[model samples]
Target: MSELHHYLELNDPVAMVWRKGNSQDPFTDRNDLLPVINGIITLLEIPSSQHKVHIDGMVEINQELYNQTSALLPEQFLVNYANGSIQFHPQHEGATFSCKYKGKGLILYPASRIYAMVRRHPDVVKTLQEIIDEAHTKLNDTHLAMDQVEQAIREAHDASAKASMAADWASQAAANATDAAHNASHAVDSTKLLFKPAVSDMKELLRTHLNPQVGWTVQTYKDGIRYRYDGKDWVPIDIFGKNIQLVNEHTDGLMSSSEHSKLKSIPLETKERVIVFCLPSYLFQGVQNIVARFPFKGEIVGIKAICGVPGDTDSEIIIEKSMNMKDWHNIMSRPVQLDAFSHYDDGQAVVDRATVYAGDCFRLHVVKQGLNIQNVTVEMIIKI
Candidate 1:
């Protein structure tokens, strides 16, 4: 029998082959029949003129979207799909531009020609069938791989979500620990005030005591006076008595009422302290405001201004003191003037203002600024 008859007898495999009238020629073209697409927009290398040139595949000129007539229409251009060549319209001669399209057109053979070849070599049909089956198996494997990748991605997302939740819990735990520590510290401070030791005086108390905590107290046996260490000094406790005599520190003798009154009028020099604020040279434009609080009962004894660098001009630094942050009055009789590279101090003079109690607000207003000054330090002395 003929080879064609023998092939046909083997379960009619020829009928299972591609039924398309024009099948791509695997020998002369790529294994895949589909054209390779140029997905990105790119410039056309060849001139889009009347000359017929092989573009390698179908040409999709972007100009078509703008002017539809300049497309693959029969009246506008001539195309040979079999050879992948195109001849542009005469009107678009020698035009160079960007174009995007698929490359390498499929080389198709007529079904009649393939049938004739299949009759001479029936094995060719079987080989083609085997290739199709192998391709199907590979496509199935690819689908399985894609599914595994998707599952891995889902697992990674769940792990990330758990990590974020763990981080949130850790942050909350840290905040709670911080609050507990703060409460413990406050409790320790309150306990220190209630549980202080009864020592003779500050000298003997500090000899053994390492931590001289604030608000702790000490008593002197000789004077029968109880003094509290108010952070800076061992202040005498305010005790109301019917008959109290003022005694000197060196000589424990009774003091006259006049001497006691004078002592009350002016605070001791050792109890004087300073509060300093430095103003940069750049802030010499307008009025600068400063607000401070006195922690102890005191009086503003003095104001001093010191310049670090000398300038060409002098500065009349007008210092005004305010108790309520609204109404203000000059602390000096006139504006304090500081020469170049000099210091100005309003001597320890008490104004008509009353003594400032604890928690009282003191504000200073600097009205004028020195020109080209390098550094300015303003110091206010308080007598407690």
Candidate 2:
């Protein structure tokens, strides 16, 4: 068995001895002679613009007094990284400063007379010290200002981050609102399908369920008329109905189709199966029952229709007919014979026998009048 060497985190050996029966280790040791490294010497700070005192001396600054003043370095003398010698020109009129020359070495200060002026005029040291102290204070203030700038930058960065987070939250809120609106729309559609009125026989269904006591005439609609109903009284439905702001100040579209409010419409045709009818333009709401008319070629065996009010305001649907389109009579009205055909929340449906003479076309009228309510939807299912 043999032992292995183990090293510490600092890679220093805890113990050293002969290995593998060797007489001595393969390393030699000797005393390490190191020079004393003194603390860094700081130089006095002064501007070169006017402080530089050129003293062509014959000697150098005394090692004991060199680089011993603490002050802020000038803008030109400040270094980024690595260390280098920077000249500090202090404010002084005399050439008491000295430096080493190329070949001559020791260059005496004051050229010849003041080779060591500071050494002789020792009182000058006190005055120079005072000047250096003032410079040190200025430099310290500059450092403090730089530190404050860094702190302001950090604070601004934090504020910007918070604003970004707030924006993200606002975006999330908008997305949630959109989802809720979409779900509410879907629920409304489901409710409509659940409560939709369904009927197969038009004539019998109307005679048994509608105002058979009143005159009932089939109001023919143009092709492609859409069917719709309101959940509450037409009062609430008025707000939902697509309306054109009528500036009653001016008379418009008295008899023109273009000026009248447009309505959703469908085609009126003779078909073997049940078909839907539609009309163009707004509903006829007045004593006039002439809102829309349809003229089909063939004969119709069965006819069913659905109609209702669009506002909570009271109104009536009068389906009047005239063989000559001049004198007309009603076949069906809402609220029995006591009132005309109408509905505020519920749909008013009717079925009746309607036959068109081969030579004479049938003329149907939709007369309505009252309030601001003017439009309603009607779906027709006719069997040929």
Candidate 3:
């Protein structure tokens, strides 16, 4: 039994052990420690930008100050999972903020007692050895079978290559035959005597004096309309008779489902609302508030910030909106970056945050102005 225990320990996947067993029972006497561990930590800081600070290993956070601890509300702060940092909303700056949270760690797995029990039984060890020997013999036979299959695959691949070459030759022959037939169909008969006259030459000959075939066509220069002879009379041709069915702008067209879908995708509504903000003689980087009231209820489609003259340095501006002159929120996902060469920055309107009701009072915040940038214009487009 002692020799079997030594063999099991020596043949183990890893030989090193961090924490050995504290138990007296032989089955639970030995246990190798795993690397998995977890713990909690506390951090304190005063933030300046957006009133946010970084906390390491903080899976969760609870504010602790002056012998009082309370869980921070999700709305009061925003968690940045990518960098493991927390950004608190407006205010909460210049104050001591402490966060207590558990650190991230690998999942804990208890030591295996089954391996110890198996190592103790000699009969089980003998059965396992027999099974392992059988598996080794079967593995050798599988290797031999795999070699045979590889040889067969190589022969089959060679045959498939020959077949592919044959198929290509057949396809080329068929294409050549089709081209010959197309050329034959389009070839004009030189045996038939026909007169080729221009519109000016045909104008001298009257309709009664002209000899026309059933499928003969003539174009008039006066109205630019084509006339086709129908054996009895010459009739004006309707080019779009089979293709278009015009009723109204929305319900027009005799088209397929896919064609109708494509037509609906085209934006026909040309009505656009533009709100312009002008920065007159502004040289410093600061926020500009433009107070305005929405006249009609509509959805915001897009926003464009245009500058007449781009400054020497790159400029960036953030647009925010506030209802009732308080509680401002960013309308733009990110700050619009401007440069000397480019004077315009376009942004797509976020549907949920951009909707405005009629008679709603709102203001635009054009913050973070660049150096020496003047005559700045911000355009907000609304879709009715």
Candidate 4:
């Protein structure tokens, strides 16, 4: 008979039992038997409230009872089952255990090691769907944000184009306005020159107004002299005598001279009004030439002239007005031939002279004329 003792190793998940004669040495050098120990612990049944079991010193059991208990052992722990007998041998020094199977080897492992041998399983569809859904949502948000950004850029480009066009139009409009203003100013200047009088009018006035038959002669008065014209008609003395001095003094004098010499002397104090005439038929249409001069400002009113040649079918009358005295533009008239003395009265159809400011200057343009012909003479009547 033998006594048995049981111990469990918590860190190794193994249980061991020893059987010895009374006073036998304690078991040792049996660590390699841990797997076999765990297998035995799994095969035995322990009695307790929560399946706890303990090993106590026991002498022996009946042979029949030991054999039945041995039958309950796991397959790896049974040896010589067909013989209906069990034998134990010590494999390590001071160990009281033997291999349960004599020729075959069995190794037991911890529960954790068994679990490690199993493969892991996961829900593939669930994970893939979550990933896909998140991607779809992010893509949709990105597309929307990109659309907003593009729209803003388009709006900004449109606004810039509109502003550029407006600026171009404004610049063009300013240029046109400037050109129109310049043209208007030129038109006004042309009108002014057409009405100015020249130096020739003063000489003509002196010739017409002063006569010898009238008293107050230029030969009798040099500086200042009074002359008797009639009973109560004694005129006062002046530079341009009452009437006769003007005819005598200006008739033979040099108009361009700056000094008063005997041959070119003129009364320095007196001024006279000049008159001239222009006939549209003989002057403007017949000889095709007209030129006159005046002293100050005046207007052309009428023309009177005598004809030298007989009236012909080609004769015509054309009156042209001009802002510049050199270039005449058309005003009014009809076609006629002159064979005798004739008159052309323009009436209110006149070109009036304008006053010039001190520092300002003006110019006139003869834009167009009534008739186009070769030769003509125009006698103009001007009032100053």
lDDT string, candidate 3, 40-64, tens digits: 1112211222323322111223344
On TM-score, who's better, 2 or 3?
Answer: 3
Candidate 3 deviant stretches above 4 angstroms: 1-270, 346-352
Q: Supply candidate 1's per-residue lDDT for 190.
A: 46
> Judged by lDDT against the true structure, how good is candidate 3?
0.50
Ranking of all predicted structures according to lDDT, beginning with the best and ending with the worst = 1, 3, 4, 2
- Give the candidate order by descending TM-score: 1, 3, 2, 4
Model 1: per-residue lDDT, tens digit, 1-384?
Answer: 101112243443233121122333211211112222331212222222332322221233444352655444322334343344445544444443222232322333323223312444335443454556678999999999999999999999999999899899999999999999999987765445432656654577668566666778666554456666656666777432324455654433356556756677884457787777776543243345466666788886776777677545566665555557666666555554666555553343334554667766654444544445556777777898
Best by TM-score: 1
Task: Report the number of the highest-lDDT candidate.
Answer: 1
Give me the runs in candidate 1 sitting further than 4 Å from their true place: 1-152, 155-270, 341-355
Candidate 2 has a TM-score of 0.21
Lowest summed-lDDT stretch of 10 residues in model 4?
49-58
In angstroms, how far off is 293's CA in candidate 3?
1.3
- Candidate 1, backbone clash total: 0
Off by over 4 Å in 4: 1-290, 293-295, 324-327, 333-378
Tell me the RMSD of model 4 versus the true structure: 61.0
Worst 10 residues of 1 by lDDT: 26-35
lDDT of 2 by residue, 114-185 (tens): 222244444433344445567799999999999999999999999999989989899999999999999998
Evaluated against the true structure, the overall lDDT of model 1 is: 0.52
Error of 2 at 280 (Å): 7.7
Model 2: number of backbone collisions: 41
